[model samples]
Target: MFEPEKMKSKGLKLERMANRLSNAIEKANHNYEIEFEAANKYL
Candidate 1:
């Protein structure tokens, strides 16, 4: 049986995980940008 409640719960869990992954990626990108800017200043 395909249960609507189970599907919804699974969807919510996936969404939460995706959000965390994206946040981590954003932080990494921010750090990379800062390092790039500093390197650029030295050039």
Candidate 2:
């Protein structure tokens, strides 16, 4: 799902931006998982 070369060829700034976006997405996924776990507690 990740294309580092495609990101690199775009631009250094783009590459960094992509990396930051990936981190943000991962954080979001973690938050979602935690929320799901909390919700499941009463289920």
Candidate 3:
């Protein structure tokens, strides 16, 4: 019983970390797109 509870807690921690990493990647992509468009206008 104690073992299952510990496993569940570890799973939740991994899920949260994956979510944070994806969010950061998405924000970085958005910023890059904005910069690329602005650079094109100046060219």
Number of clashing residue pairs in every model?
0, 0, 0
Ranking by TM-score: 1, 3, 2
Better-scoring candidate (TM-score), 2 or 3: 3
Best by lDDT: 1
Tens digits of per-residue lDDT, candidate 1, 6-36, equal: 9999999999999999999999888843346
Return the lDDT, model 2, position 17: 96
Among all windows of 10 consecutive residues in model 1, the one with the lowest summed lDDT is 32-41
Arranged by lDDT with the best first, the candidates are 1, 3, 2
Name the top TM-score candidate: 1
lDDT assessment of candidate 3:
0.87
Q: Each candidate's root-mean-square deviation in Å?
A: 4.8, 9.9, 4.7
Write down the TM-score of every candidate: 0.69, 0.48, 0.68
Please provide, for model 2 over 5-41, each residue's C-alpha lDDT reduced to its tens digit, 9 standing for 90 to 100.
9777778888789999999999988884334666776
Model 1, which residues run further than 4 Å from truth?
A: 33-43
User: Whole-model Cα lDDT per candidate?
Assistant: 0.88, 0.82, 0.87
